[model samples]
Target: MSIQAASNSEKPPQEDNYQPPSSLSSLPDDVVLNCLARVPRSDDLNISCVSKTLRSLVRSPELCRLRSRLPKKSLYLFYHFHQDSKRCHWITLRRGEKMITSTHDYQVEQRSCSLAGLLTSPHFPTFYSSGVSVGSEIYFPDHGWPFPSTKVRVLDTRSGTIRMVPSMKVARWAHKKAMGVVDGKIYVIGGTYGKNQVEVLDPETQTWEFAGEEKVQCNSRFSAPLEDKVYMVDLEHGRISAYSPREGINNVATERLIEHMNCMCVVENVIYACFKRSGLMWFDTKLKVWRRLIDSGGKATLCSFNAGKMAEYEGKLAVFWTQINTNFVEKVDIRCRIIALDRVGEEIRGKIESSGSVATCSYSITLSHCLVVSD
Candidate 1:
């Protein structure tokens, strides 16, 4: 026996047969591009880290154009808390699948669920005014404060990018003013105390012009986008008004006084306004009348903590609000719920679509703003 010991440097037999896992690059260029287009906009950052090919695809403008054509739609709720802090915490709530019960009724839990993403960059200016969502973009017009110059900040929800656009011609903040999108243009109505000006900005042209000054100033809290015009509620005058780019502002004289309305949103040409004490009400443009829908139940939970906000989520009206419980020791649980509503004749039914909660030492959580954007 010559004691022929195997050389220490000899490689294992299995090592020679090993192969690397397949990568996205192995697929055809078009196939890979289509796959990347399907990824959620918020997950683009993570997907780009997979490989060099994917990194290139994600950053290309062509990818964005392709994504816009995809049939899939995602609903996102963006809200901000803590207005006094220098850095505002922006949380994003994604609309999740509804859970069906044994009785065939859909139940949306009233709790705080997992967050889709968070934005706390200093670049995100604090906005006391409501934001208008155009397609996949949300425009926040900041009140001229720490900085003298007034400018509009645009957040591309699809790409998770934020940029500052040209300053408004009037250099006025949207404080207590109405902002909405109509006919591919952004209309900012009302202004600081005693300033009744209507400014409209065309994103395509990147220019702002005064729409017109009418006697009826728009109530910021009760205005929303409807078809080709913007529908607004004149609580003081006990009437509803519609502003058309071609015909100017015209009031729909009515006896319904919407002064107590806390928030409003438009769905399927119907204007839904939520009153703190009266629950939900819908304004019929065809009938020119305000009708009461469902009484205050789960819908009222949104306004229980602070003033709730409403947005259209996939053709349905969605309301978001916070609830605080102080039973725990040294910790307060703040529950957030998103309620979705369905239209059935004059009756509007609601279900809790998503719920999440967070425990903190603070007694209550205040929701300063809310917006719904499609991705």
Candidate 2:
């Protein structure tokens, strides 16, 4: 009896010592990365806290490459508000799975993503200045206004870390300045009051170099990088100029594309510009011609009170417009329209795939700046 009792005690101890399988930890690095890549980037902060391996994977370059392949698309909107003081917030809008009907019709739903501690950093910039995003980082030029100081604020979307990077060679506020990122270098075309100079910054080295001086006056308020060249729109002259590091600035196209452009974004190597009254127009770099994109049955019409901003989202052009009403109880109505482009014969045309009002807010909300970033 004593021997049997001792054997039972030993069996119970052996059972207690047995460990369960760690399915996740045992997964291959690639498999683990593939799984984590599908997760929303906004949740990376909390996801990384799970373990050291996960934290490293979240910051790994391979994971970013995997994320770029995932079918799910996320559009992050960064907006600045200032009623009494300067403040900014990042709102993530994700496109839900497409539902198809038996009639061969489909619908895309846009929903706000839950982001916790993503934009809560104290170092986030509050001022509304011109900015550009390259890879996973966004750079904002902060030339001390009223007082000349050279400083650039850089925001890393992955970890939600905002830090000040090396300033530009010259102290220039990004307001009304032409900025573009090419070949991993940030080029800033400065010199208001008729003097045009080009400065380039290498983020890798955290250094700035003078690219060259532009012969033509770069008075454009918007600039975007396409392929190897940078396109700058001259609203005053109704011309678009292409700048290359090897070659100087050259006028590519000219059109009276309205006196003022609300915002501009590049999609599929073509530049699209939005006007307050004239509607939407695009510039064809291949033909060096400007053509009006008809709204195809009033799909994109702007009111006098509507303020519109355009951005390239997942190879499609997205326009976000907000109408503010002082008399109405509802202060602002934010509307978004996604346009998909297709070639109808020889002419390229866009059709509105999805359109709806995304959100509404009180009158106290002041949208100073907006930019779309993919996560």
Candidate 3:
């Protein structure tokens, strides 16, 4: 249903001179602002749809007082596609931006330069994967197994200047599986590194340090830079944990063990984690509890929602699945229909959207040693 229709159906009671309930009516504006800060980005939009008064309150810049407490701009990711044609292109998507749009394609000039320069070659998972930026450098690690021989390079995208940076001396660091930045340090976590180790890189000094071995089971996906913590998933066992440097780089298992967590993403401070077997796991940082999202599951087979390949787009959690037969990539936003936390797992709620070309082969792999760009 359209947002307008949904709002009209739940029209709030209107009193001639309605004073909201004493609880809400008497709340200081600042107190109300704190409540709004805890709401997920999508729910804030729903508040805009609820009523004129609420819409105004939620949209006001005054509500952003808590956002200023954040240390950095919400992370922006640019996924590059360097097809096998010796050409490279990129699309930049900021977490707060509305959409991902194609930009420009740059040519791969060197055969032995950084991995981004190897786009024209036929090595799979070369320059495509989720990555984060620290200072002027962006790191893209190999996503698949038997990690390719790569050289780490930092790029001045503006000047198209590429310079080699510190790389893991050991091979297959799972450099592509997941990456995050915390306290000015870069953490490269699990993929296919032999025995699974977390590789920490300091961009300021151009150096690399081996933090420790990854504890989660192999093939279990993990995500980092969620609030003050980095999360690791025991996918096969349905367990979860977070890493905090304040405590040490060691993985500290969470008291809440969620099963089958195949896909994970963070919005604001909460982690929206999805499991293939049990459905969606809603982790509230403030409450320190597990609220199962039951409404977002069930239709996975019909929706072609694989519990992998999810990305946050424009402040909404987008789940992506590839259709092999049609060579299509599809996405769904589960935020708009979230009525309660338990529904995150039980209902197949939200609008499903798809994009990209029919040819899946026309893709780019961002490698740890190379950068992938898409136009």
Candidate 4:
């Protein structure tokens, strides 16, 4: 009993079991990278917080190349259910590694995650062009949405600088599917009170001119461009045709395709459709018939479930679908699948590389419009 040394101030005893944490740096960069490559991307953000060394490693290009073990497709999804919950979901389609029970074979299970609230309500783009090839440069009217203007402003994707470009021949703009990019110019369908006139702008010369007066009338609100041709699908008219920018030929084909398909897209000069009943299908240009999609595991069940929309990403087919809960009071689940294609003569095989859920919303949302985008 050291009564003389027993002062009020005292420090807690150190636990002998405590030791400094191990560092990944202790391991070789290649070894660390190999271990990290197996980690789920969802956990990467958290792992980056562990140490400064890890932060650099996780964000490094080396990790990116390694993490890209399988097919990679970045998907942007917009769902408008209510004005209050105005948020956009960004989904990352990545490969997940899993070892089978006792076999050496590995399974790539895609856990599609939606990063919600990525965009605000005011800044959220009210884009109507379903087939527009809008690049990193975000273009809008000199004024904001719902306001018609001839002047167009573009935001530099790299610098994020917004500047006004030349005005169009027609003072027309709208959110109801009005704009499209063709060739090296911007074209405005210009939705001018019953007029079919379109104004074209050349970004290189900074000039605006009128396109052909006899524009093709398309019933589809969505369109997809294949090479030099812009393909439009008219479900009501039961027609899928390719609209030529310079010529009047639409190359109307697949009258039956529009009947079964709800959404369609083109990849590698091939038109693929999501049949309302048939899951996934692609049109045979030579035979003029629809073919089934095969999953990567050599299963035909890839398109067995109903899919909503189809888009091509990174030279692959991306399919989206929603299933209504039979117990109507529950939430609905919206999902997406990316399928890789291999064409051999008349037959096309679709291998589903990854799948994920985009959103979960209430069934009360009777009329919900989903717009899917990929880059």
The models' CA-based lDDT, in order, is 0.60, 0.65, 0.47, 0.54
| Number of clashes found in candidate 2 | 0
Of 1 and 2, the candidate ranking higher by lDDT: 2
The best-first sequence of candidates by lDDT reads 2, 1, 4, 3
Local error of candidate 3 at residue 225 (angstroms): 2.6
lDDT of 1 by residue, 20-131 (tens): 9888799887888888887655457788888888888889888878977875433443433343333334445443334332211222222222222333232233434567
lDDT of 3 by residue, 65-154 (tens): 675554322222222334442333333222242433221111112222234543323442333344555654556553334443334445
Give candidate 3 regions above 4 Å deviation.
Answer: 1-90, 93-130, 135-137, 142-150, 153-163, 175-178, 189-198, 210-220, 234-239, 249-262, 277-280, 283-291, 294-304, 323-375
lDDT by residue (1-375, candidate 2, tens digit) is 699888887786668779987877689999999888877564589888988898999999999899778754345555543442334455545554343321012232222222234332222333234577766777877634554346777767666656677767766645546778888798877535566578888988888888975544576667888887888877467678888888878878756554677777788877887766667777767777756675545345422224456677756777777666556795775666777766545455787766665656665544433454445
lDDT of 4 by residue, 315-371 (tens): 667676667756556778666666667865546777655565545566533222222
Q: Residue 12, candidate 2: how far off, in angstroms?
A: 86
Which 10 residues in a row give candidate 2 its minimum summed lDDT?
101-110
Error of 2 at 47 (Å): 34
Mark the regions of model 2 whose C-alpha exceeds 4 Å error after superposition.
1-73, 97-129, 147-149, 194-196, 213-216, 254-258, 295-307, 324-330, 364-374
Give the 10-residue window scoring lowest on summed lDDT in candidate 1.
102-111
Per lDDT, the best of the predicted structures is: 2
Residue 232's lDDT within candidate 4 is: 58
